[model samples]
Target: MKKYLLLMTVVLAALSFTSCMEELGSYEYMDANEIKIDSIKGQSITQYDTLRIVPTITQSRNTSEENLEYLWYWYKSGAGENAKIDTLGFDRNLNYYVAAVPGLYSARLKITDKETGLFARKEFDISVEAENSGLLILSDLNGNANLSLLNFANIFSQDIYYAANGEYAGTNPVGIADIDNAGTDLHMIAILCADGRGGVVTEPTSFVKISDYSDLFYVMPQPIAPEAYCAVAVLYNTGMGITYDFIINNGKLHYRDFQYAAYEPLFNPEVSGDYSLAPYAILNNNTLLFYDNKNYCFNILKCSYGQLKETKLDPVPLPEGTDTETLAFDPRNVGLEMVYAAKGWKKMDNDAGYAYGIFRKPGSTDLTNMYCLRFNIGYNMSMGRDYFTPYFKHSISGATDLDKATAFAMSRQDPYLYYAYKNKIYSYDLEFDKGKVIYDTDTVVGPGARVDYLYFRPDNESFNMWAATSVEGSTEKTGSIHVLGLGRNGDIVKVDTVYRNVCGKVVGMTYKNR
Candidate 1:
């Protein structure tokens, strides 16, 4: 029985093998001769950047041995959806310039077999960064304004509005106001001027949106009295699509277009004298902080975004005899909202330190819950005596007493505060409560140079400080703009005198992202 089963199994296997061979012989095949497009990948580009792409055509067994034709085009979405696709020359390699406004874009490449009727297509995407980013130097040319532009790509200055626009030509520019508008391209620049500042107009003009190399766009008007503005700042609330341009002129604070009238004279009208100090003020955390030099107090007003106008001037209560000119609001302090200011009438206060305080407003109440502290101690006992030592070889050497707060710049990225006194720069560490002289302008700008203004570059991680120093008794009012590079810990790393022989004293300086 076993032999008979084995015989039957062998016979069945033989019959199956023969059937499989017959099925394989009857199968049909075709040649692969079609043309295919090579996949193209997406790209990222900056505005005005050149993007080069090369595409290849894949040929199969049936494809003809003929030259291939190519075409490339790109288009952007949004309002430019109806715009024409920029066509490139008939070439396999595309060298395109990404000059369009920053946005997402789509591009296509087409290939055709010249000899055969076969064709193929490919598509890809691109992202471009926003343009018009640079630094604007408002050269107060002895009252006549000269707008000097310094793009990141270049170090030298270029007069962006000199002969380009007739309106800004030979105009006396008091200062320029800039606001960082989130989301939209509403970031605008307003050249503020008055008859006193050597400007053609007596009052400030509307904020002008810059286009195509400082060409003035439509102006966003702000109500202003025919008076010279001492300080100006633009507050933008992108979430609510509202903007307010604030200006301090003739000892009055004005905002919006007469939405509400100016703050009811925060200063004493009896003080009839020329206060040469430019009104010191800054916009911080949705609040406008200004110094009432006439009253010797700090004034705070909670700004309402997108409100057509303010109904009344509700100022946060502040102690009188506060030094507004020496006020420095530290943006780095998040938890404790502290503002540092040199206390005026030092004899009355008798405090060895500047009058700085932390304040908080609760709920809907206008009252400010506050705590004031005088940080007069310069040397930290915990770190020993030498730990607070500073390098003073070429710059102002020696220890700095924190009592004379004078003019200071607050670092946004670190706990260090840079203060200028006489011709020396001092670094004060808030965390350790220690202070030391970091840089001296005595050797760099000659003996009699007095450091007046200090500015911290907001866009730089290195915490680069720009200082303006004027010679004590120079007849020409000659000064120099020095750039000091600081280390991560906020110590002076290097120094460079970028501008020298400045004819006029620099009243104020701030970094503006173009």
Candidate 2:
């Protein structure tokens, strides 16, 4: 009885299936609109270039153009799920000015058939390249800040900050730092000023303002005063390495580590200390030396786990076999105020490099009696006191009109120190303890023209000096930027080029790499 009932159930199911198939075949069927997009391809363009794309569309049901809606948008590639999507246009075509940061992105075109409520999308890759790469000059135009660019082709773009942002960078420009290779996503140009507005950071490629100086700190200081910026490489014992960007503001030091994922601020808290710091700092691999103006001493900071720790410097012990006198002053407690400091050449096998600092006795009005202190830097303090011990201290001899100098720069390949006084640039060889005038604006730029700034390209293997000079006229000051080459013996070998009357009282300069 059970087998018979099962057979009957199977027969009934087959009959019902046949009836349903016949009923469905008796009804009419309509094809839905199928949209297809083509003719769009990946693109490679430079920043600020016009990105135009016209995608060809086809529909199986021949849908009317009026019934189709178009949308175009893009987002940075690899910025998963929460990526920032920017709308381009609502038309079938796309015309966008590529103002995005230099990087890879994905652009998409979406077409929707309003009648059928069906949509189709096509995505393609885009690579945006930096439009400008060369030297960026930050100058004080009257009282406002002006940023200019000198490209590899020798073309000059003036007031690029205003051209891109429709406003000045800030007032009282102090310095500019190109922070490349600081981290995976930390490439930027920092324009520092002493104005209450602090300063600004911009996209290295587009010159678009990223944020103000206060936005970079976790807790913004009441009054902002930015003085200097630098980036240093930090190597670990496990063969790992990273670069960190440092900024000195309000006589304090702050650092940024962008590697680890966290909600922490872009810059860490100010390095805790009671002393007022100088505007200048010397950075090397894993270490930084800051001069405390209030205490008249040098403070050492070592990098560990993305944080800076104040380290103590051991006293220098004189070598037994040599007649070299003991260091006249202790680095930790020099009784003089810091006038200037600069990084010198590094030995081939040493992780640390030589550095020089100019100092004068407290409350001393005579600059002619200033002294130079030499020391090593950039090594791990855990390697022992011998790694970065002070080398020597001596008077800055043979530098004429040292009291009148306005700017100074040190050579990284030799013991050549360059300083500008009035209209002359002199190079003092620390090795020979002598000085000579290498560039005289009385003959080159003009008589009575004053040297406003001096800098050496940090990346250049050879000495390439950048000097900014200005001559005061009855109406205004005319500024010129000269790129001069230095020979092996620390003398001006040739004038590479000169941009005359290009800016106003050039104060700071930095190189923007490609």
**Where is model 2 more than 4 Å wrong at Cα?**
1-130, 234-242, 259-265, 305-326, 382-387, 473-477
lDDT of 2 by residue, 1-514 (tens): 9999999999999999999999999998889888999999997776788889888899988756888999998887767899899998898778889888766688889999998889999989887756786789988888778899987557888889998999998898899877665235446778888888788989887789999978888888666888888766532211233456677788877877644545333766777767778888776555556788888877666556445444332222324453334555666578788888888876444446788887887877565678878887745542234344677778866777665689999888998889998899999886566889988987887687889899887755567899999875422437889899999898999999988888888879877654
The TM-score, computed over Cα atoms with residue i paired to residue i, of candidate 2 is: 0.69
Residues 238-356 of candidate 1: C-alpha lDDT, one tens digit per residue: 12222344545544554442123343211111122322112444332243444444333334444343232233333333235544334333221212322343321111121112233
Residue 152 lDDT in model 1?
Answer: 42
- Cα shift from native, residue 228, model 1 (Å): 11
* Alpha-carbon deviation at 135 in model 1, angstroms: 1.9
Worst 10 residues of 1 by lDDT: 386-395
Q: lDDT for model 1, on a 0 to 1 scale?
A: 0.48
